[model samples]
Target: MDTTRSLVYIAFCAAVIAVLAQVMIPLPLVPITGQTLAIGLVVTLLGKKYGTQAVCLYIMLGAIGLPVFTAFSGGLGVLVGPTGGYIIGFIPTAMIIGLYFEKFGYTYVHAVIANIIGMFVTLLFGALWLKLFANLTWSAAFISGVLPFMIAGIVKACIAATVGLTLKRRLQQAKLLQIIQ
Candidate 1:
C-alpha cells in the first residue's frame, strides 16, 4: 500500500472502531461493545507500527472532544470518567497486541491467547484506575468494573482472534501483506 493509502486505511479503521463504541450493550459495569474486537483486528491486520498509530490516533481524537468515545461523549472528562481506565487502556492494549502479532506469526490459537491477554491488560489498567481515581475498594471495583465484563471480554477476544487469523491468512494469500509491509 502506498503511504497515503495506508494512512487513510488506518484512519478509516480508527473511525470505525470509534463508531462501534457507540453500539454498546449496557452492562452492570461498563457497557460492552465491539471496539476491543476491532482494535485486535486492526492490530492483526496492520501490524505493530501502523496498528499502534491507528489506536493512538483514535485516542487523540477522543481526548480532543471529538465524541468518538462511547455515547458520543469525549473531552478531558471522559478520560477521568468511571470508564476512563478502559478508554485509556486502549493505548497499551493496542501496543501489546501489535507487538504480539509482529513477534509471533498469526495462528488461531495464539491470536486467541493474544487477544485475551490484551483485554486482560486493559481490564487491569482500568480496574486500577477505578480504584485510584474513583476511590473504589478493590472488591467493589472488581465487582463493578471487571467481573461483569469478564464473559463479554472473553467472547470478544475469541471472535477477534478468529477474525484476525482468517484475515491474516487471506492477506498473506493475496499478497496484500507484502504491500502493507
Candidate 2:
C-alpha cells in the first residue's frame, strides 16, 4: 500500500475501535464491549504490522487523554486504573491475531480462532492488572474479569469474525488490499 493508504487504514481502524469501545454490556468488574470485536476486525482487515500499528495508535491516543476509551474516558490515569491492563493488552492481541491472518489468509473460521486467542491475551493482561490494581486474589480477579466474559467473548468474537472476514473479502475483491506476496 502507498503511504497515504496505509495512514488512512491505520486512522480508520483506530477510529472504528474507539467507536466500538462505546458499545458494551456493563458488568461489575468489566464491561462486555465491542472493543474486542473491533480489534478482531482491525487485525483481520489490516494484517500483522499495520493492524498492530493501528491498535497501538488507538491505545496511544486513549492514553494521551483523547477520551477515546470506554465510557468516554481516557488519560494516563486510565492506563494505570483497573481496566488499564485490558487497554494495554490490545497490542499483543492485535499482533497475534494479525499474524494468524497474515499467515493463514482471511477466513471466517481462522478469524474466530484468532479473536479467541486474542481475548485470552487480553484476559491475561486484564486479569493480572485487575488483581494487582484492585488488590484482589487471583481467583477473585478471574471471577470478576474472565469468568463472566468467556461465553460472551466467544460469541462476540464469532460475530466479529463473520463481519470482518466478509468485509475483508469484499475489500480484497475490490483490490483495496495489494495482497503482495
Candidate 3:
C-alpha cells in the first residue's frame, strides 16, 4: 500500500467504524459497542498517525450531524449528551492505543493494555461529563455511567486486542505494515 492507498484504507475503516456505531446492542447503561473495537484495531494496524486521523475523521463526521453515532443519532446534542464524553474520549483513546503501537509495535498483550488504559480514559471523561451535565454526584454518576459498563468494556477490550493482533499479523505477513505507517 502506498501512502494514498493507506490513507484511503484508513478513511474507509473509519467510515466502517462510524457506521458500526449505529448498530448498538442496547444495554441498561452504555451500550455494548463495536466502535471501540474498531478504534483499537485501526490504531494497531495503521499506527499512531493514520490511526489518530481515522478516529478524528470519524468524530468530525459524527459531530457534523451525520448519523454516525450509536443509535444513528448525531449533532451537537450528542456531543452534550450523556454519551458525549465517551465520544469525546475516543480521540485520546485512539492516541493512547496508537502510542503503544508506535512505541512497542503491535502485540496482543500491548494492545490489551493500551485498550484497558483507553477505557479508563473514557471512563474518566465520561464520568466527569455525566457529573457536569446531569448534576449527579460522583457515585451516582459512576453508577449510572461507568459501573455498568465495566465488565462489558473489559470483554470488548479483550476482543479489540485480539482483533488488533490478528490484523497486525495479517498485515505483517502481507508486508503492508510498512506502507501503513
Candidate 4:
C-alpha cells in the first residue's frame, strides 16, 4: 500500500473502533462494548502494522478527549480511570492477534484462538487496573470486572473471527487490500 492508503486505512479502522465502542451493554463496573470486536476485525484485516497503528491512533484520540471511548467518553482522565486499562490493552491485543495470524495463517481456527487470547489479554489488563483504580481486592476485581465479561467476550471473539476473516477475504477479492499482504 502507498503511504496515503496506509494512512487512510489506519484512520478508517480507528474510526470504526470508536463507532463500535458506542454499541455497549452497560454494566455496573465495566460495560461490554464492541471495541474488542473492532479490534479483532482491524487486526484480521490489516495485520500487525496497520492494525497496531489504528489501535494506537484510537487510544491517542481518546486520550486527547475526542469522545471516542465508551459512551463517548475520552481524555487523560478516562485513560487513568478504572476502565482505562482495557482501552490501553488494545495495543498488545492487536499485536498478538496480528502476530498469531501472521505466524499461523488466517485459518478460522487460528483467528478464533487469536481473538480468544486477545480477549483474555484485555481482561487481565482491565482487571488489574480495576483493582488498583477502584480500590478493590483482586477477587473483587475478578468478579466485578473480568468474570462478568468472559462469556460475552467469547461470543464476540467468535463473531469477530468469523466476520473479520470473511470481510478480509471479500476485501482482498475486491482488491481493496490486494497489496496489503
Candidate 3 lDDT tens digits, 1-181: 5778777877887887787686577866567677776777677767777888898888888889988888887798999988888889888988888777778766678878888877777778888898998788999889988887778678878887887778778877887665664
* Candidate scoring better on TM-score of 1 and 3: 1
lDDT of each: 0.82, 0.86, 0.80, 0.92
Question: What are the runs in model 2 whose C-alpha is more than 4 Å off?
Answer: none
- Candidate 1 has a TM-score of 0.91
TM-scores, one per candidate: 0.91, 0.95, 0.90, 0.97
* Candidate 3 positional error at 29, Å: 5.0
* Model 1 lDDT, residue 77, Cα: 90
Between prediction 1 and prediction 3, the one with superior lDDT is 1
Candidate 4 deviant stretches above 4 angstroms:
none
lDDT of 2 by residue, 45-136 (tens): 78888889989999999988998999988899989988899989999998888778778866677888988998899888899999999898
Tens digits of per-residue lDDT, candidate 4, 1-181, equal 7999999999999999999999999988789999998998889889988999999999999998999999999999999988898998999999998888889989999999999999999999999898988989999999988999999999999999999889889999998888664
Worst lDDT window (10 residues) for model 3?
172-181
Full-model lDDT, candidate 4: 0.92
Cα lDDT of candidate 2 equals: 0.86
Task: Name the candidate that leads on TM-score.
Answer: 4
What TM-score does candidate 4 reach? 0.97
